[model samples]
Target: MILDAISSAAGTSSAAKDRAGIADNFDTFLQILTTQLKNQNPLEPLDTNEFTAQLVQFSQVEQQIKQNENLEAITQLAAATAATNAVSFVGKRVSVSTTQSELTNGTANWQYSAAKDADAAKFTIRDSAGKVVWTGERDISKGDNNFTWDGRDAGGLKLTDGNYTLSVSAKDADGETVTVGIAAEAIIDGVDFSGEEPLLLAGDTTIPMSSVKRIHNQ
Candidate 1:
């Protein structure tokens, strides 16, 4: 009877709370069983099989509760480790796997790796609203290449400081399309842990820690 009562309570409580309830009920169950056995009629004895089954069920419930506690501990440990790692990125410049970068003051910078030398490589700049802002020839090398913008549109007009997207197109001497992978760099200012995963804050932008490709000196 007490086991049935505790089982119903276990359904609605958390592992820690349910575990305590189960323990209390289990103690009461043992006492009741002992008293029943002692006062039981000898002609019609209490069924040992039913008592054994109840004991086994209580054992299983306790084991499951312990396992739930362990899993919670592991999850909390993992979240703490991630927050620790994210905090270390503060003030560090990291290359993120994105085509977007912020233009601060009068300059913005990006980097890309070229698959091969492009005879007609060009860089295209787009504003936050996806409007074409600037386009020009890109002097790309075989390996690493860095591109910097002066926050100027194609007509030499200064543009406002904000986020912009960079797109690069390249072609070899034979006019075949070449691969150009764009990477945006930003100095992490802080960490936002409100989300499920930590996000690195760079000024007004929020970048996921998982998108970080390289960590440079502060």
Candidate 2:
């Protein structure tokens, strides 16, 4: 009987239900075999090759079913781990590559790269309303320049402590425009892990970890 063969091969009764449900109308095959044996004129019986082929097919199908179940279990485990790791990013300030953002508490920082030596470099900071809030000049060589802006207008008025966008343009000794990289810092309020890679959320923008040049503690 198919049930007997399954029980012997599986080595446990716990999987009997699974094995039995695999074959559709399997009991009908057993009934037909019994009837043929009783009614056959003893001249013909079931062919041996046919019976062997059926047994092999059953074994292959049983293996596939077990493999599928194992795969499902593995997928569930991975999903659980991703959910746990994504929560760890909450409430952390991270440095990511971005052009513009509002500076909270009237303070923001920028990183400047010099392509060539400049006699004088000018840094301009703007507020969220696109108004020039502060301007400063520095004599720097061809290198990095760090500039921080306190929320202030040209009139020397302290703006309200909130988010403000910043834009900077630098000129070299030749009075030609030089390219400078701009970056901002923000607190990671959440993380998204459903995609192929993790994404860090900084206030409103989602930034990939690849764009993160450095990390700092404040």
- Angstrom error of the Cα, residue 206, model 2: value is 4.0
Q: Which pairs, if any, clash in model 2?
A: 102-164, 103-164
How does model 1 fare in lDDT? 0.89
lDDT of candidate 2 over 13-57, digit per residue (tens): 444255566554355455656676678676676565765676677
- Which digits, one per residue and each the tens of the lDDT, describe model 1 over residues 93-151? 99998999999999999989999988868889999899999999855778987888999
By lDDT, the best candidate is 1
